[model samples]
Target: MPKRRWLVAPPAPSTFSARFPQFPPLIAQIFYNRGITTPDDAQRFVGMEDVAANARIGDDPFKMNGMSQAVERIRRAIREGEAIGVYGDFDADGVCSTALLTEALKKLDAKALPYIPHRINEGYGLNSDALKDLKEKGACVVVTVDCGIRSLGEVEAGTALGLDMIVTDHHSVGNELPRAVAVINPKQNDDAYPFQEFAGVGIAFKLAQALSDAQQQSPLPNAQTLELDALLDLVALGTVADLVPLVGENRTLVRRGLARLNKTERPGLQAMMQQAAGKNRSMSAGTIGFFLGPRLNAAGRIEHARTAYKLLTTQYPGEAEQLAAQLEATNRERQKLTDEMTQKAREMVAALPPGEFILIAGSPDFPEGIIGLIASKMQEDAYRPAIAMTHKDGVMRGSARSIPEFNIVAALDECADLLVRHGGHAAAAGFTVDNTKYDALHARLRNIAERELSRLELVPTISIDAEASLSDMNWKLLEHLDQLAPYGYGNREPIFLSRNIMVKSARLVGTEHIALVVSDGVVVWDAIAFRQKEALPKLAPLPKQVDLVYTLASKVWQNEPRLQLEVKDIRVADL
Candidate 1:
């Protein structure tokens, strides 16, 4: 742990409610801080629906990039009764995107099968052999979801075989886009879609929307009517897991999507819920990201992601239950692997120069599939740029985690001359490089970090909310905070900084927890700091007062409800 720095947050702004008349002062202040200002915006923020309107269906279909040709090509295949296959990636986003389109096609009475490549065995995105195999299955058209943006060679192979492909993905496009019939990714250089922050599932949903609109407008006899809304559950799961900013259309989709998830009653979800007993029926973002998403993701991490996809979209209750349980068990196994690998990676990085800005470690058995989780854990432990790698077949594959100050993908781009492939956002990314170049890559990366990072970058700081009095620690205050529900990666719970207070009593409770009863004349607050038992000797005997920055939360002990404060940082009072 590092030494604490004491600083007080400014008082709450007065424009909290005046600017947004719909919210209570506290809720309004929270909304204002979170950047939701107008009444219309606040309403949409809470309810998730601003305007009830369908997606825009482009006219002069040929004017849209590749879509017109792809759709017409697919319709011809259906008329000729040619088999069609859907290929997907192996992550939550990929699974949902694949399932969304498959369901939409099924609803429209089209015969389409799904195929997801294994993460460990097949790696990411589309591949040459996989496309050829699909083409051999009597398929004339192939649709790809959440992948294929970087698969130029694979697309060309299918095109040469007279196979048309429609690519729906959200990854950044390479210099050369795939020659697929229609590429629906918003990141494409020629794409004009207004929203660019969609997750892979969101892109797939947009295609479904467009397909439905096209069907509705067609004058052909017995034309199928498309239904796209049925896939929102998958969209919400994928979008939130992929960590896209939940604002605008994304926000509306997730807000309503979570509601649908709670009452989902889908055979697959119900079976998963039974496997994960004791969970609340009213699922929140935490439930999806922490509980469900991980279990679904575990199949990809340790084995193949197809099991998770099948579990989500399966109709057989028995098969769903068995698959969901298998996924739950796999997640537990994944936790053990990640924890061990993370610990080893940390020790390896710690042996390097303590001031090194970038923490890079690798091994032959680091488990290629879970390097991302290991990198994230290492980053949390060291608060630095982290990369965890695994070497196989003369190639090194890895995942990188970075802070807000550093653009990891850009850093990789700077080193692209050495990398075989790399792509992702600023905070996180994935890459592969030749094993022979590993040493030079390490040296170059460290050099870049040394020049870029400063001393302040080593230590992490907690952001505190407005200063409060000990009197403010009460049921009412805690209840008021509940309005900020559905907390997760983007929207976090509030952290309050309380002024001068005395430690009424302090003791070591659990093996490594410091329990404190702090008091001001107006109120008393119970506080706890995990893994801080050593602080008890100094804090318990303190006669002087203290100032603390903390977060207010509810603690239930033996079914008894009580207010508790989580101390973020603390300092002895100057007075």
Candidate 2:
């Protein structure tokens, strides 16, 4: 792995800190780093104040462009007893969106049919064959979740088949919007929605909220209703898993959703927790991202996403347990496959002459499912944009992962003529191309990356939120930071820098981790440096002094709760 650049955040001005007298200086500085400048904003961010009321128009689902039209059409479908198909991508975000919307529609007595495309066979997003299948199964209306923003042709084909298309996606929009009945994407150029970073499931939740509001105004006798909060578990799962910025409405949703998730009565989720995490383990954003999300996603990456969708929606405990076990096994297999392919990809990149702006690796033997994982590993290890492709039968499918300096999707857009289908966000994207165009596509993307990134430093950087003394480490400080729960993507855990700490004792923990006891003379703390065993030689030879960048966490060992430093980076102290 490339050594990361450390960028320490500048301290907030004293005048700015004076506005929030209640916060500790450290807490205030951390909040300022997160763009929380005012006392009111701080209170809202920490949940001391009502987030929804302070959200202006952002919390109101109807304010989103095309929301009203989508709700009206969906209500009409419910009233007319027309079958509605909820089509979703294969990833966790897409699967959760499908389950959330399908459950919500079913609550309103709508005939909801959920469909998630297979990763290998059908690929991502809306497809003509899937749409036709839904139509044949009596679906008069098809609502796309998490995908379809760039699928103009697919939407047209569905519309031509008399399927009223309502697209609810969160991906970056294409040049022209799909000709659908209603397109509910906050990222649209003309959208008035104040918050635009909702994950696909977030948009689906908003649609459900709108439907619930509509239902309340006009009574549908004998129609079942669902509490909006009930669906938040799914929202949190998808929002966090999709890696959307957890700020604004997304943060609020995840905050409340985490609460729901910990107490979720969904048998499938409970079973999954038992299989993956302990049954008693509390669900956090980390839990979802590291444990639950991967297992849910493993189904899509390995086989079919419907297995995960079923696990989320099933009411039977027995079936949930079975499905959860299957997912666990599949996730393990996925991990093994990813590791093997990533090594292969690294070898392929290593053979190239150094200093390439972007790394491209392809193999005929690469599994279609884990290409994205391989690309992500390559990008992280190399600190450059990486694309992993798998070729089969004169066609190629590639998944791209990019650094902050490069927009992978935009680069793909520049080579549109060479692609059969392509869509994604700034940092990640997927594309399909004929084998004949693969070389041209790779060259065009490489040129685009080089032109955009040649002038800049390309190394990955670890951002340090503030500098703190070891004395500042305590339960109180950890509690203050805990207010910023459900951290992911945009809203990250605060990383603090503490310099010249003595490593009193150190030992290797796991294969690539170091467990250490450190002190700043008067204050001693337990710390763990993950994946940093290679740097052990620098800290070892005992009582070595070093500068450490880390996050604070409370962990239980031997039935006791203790403060532990989760080290992000460590370096030798300057003489």
Alpha-carbon lDDT, every model: 0.76, 0.90
Over 89-193, each residue of candidate 2 has an lDDT whose tens digit, in order, gives 899999999999999998999999999998988888889999999999999999999999989999999999999999999999989999999999999988988
- Decoy 2 TM-score against native: 0.97
TM-score of 1: 0.87
Error of 2 at 63 (Å): 1.8
Task: Please provide TM-scores, in order, for all candidate models, with all chains considered together.
Answer: 0.87, 0.97
Which portions of model 2 miss their true places by more than 4 Å? 48-58
Off by over 4 Å in 1: 1-17, 47-73, 219-226, 277-281, 454-458, 470-486, 501-575
Highest lDDT: give the candidate number: 2
Query: After superposition on all CA atoms, what RMSD does each candidate show versus the true structure?
Result: 3.9, 1.8
The candidate that achieves the highest TM-score relative to the unseen native structure: 2
Tell me the tens digit of each residue's lDDT in model 1 across 22-132.
444556666666777677776655652332333332233233366666667666666667777889989898898888888876666666878899887788877777878
* CA lDDT for candidate 1: 0.76
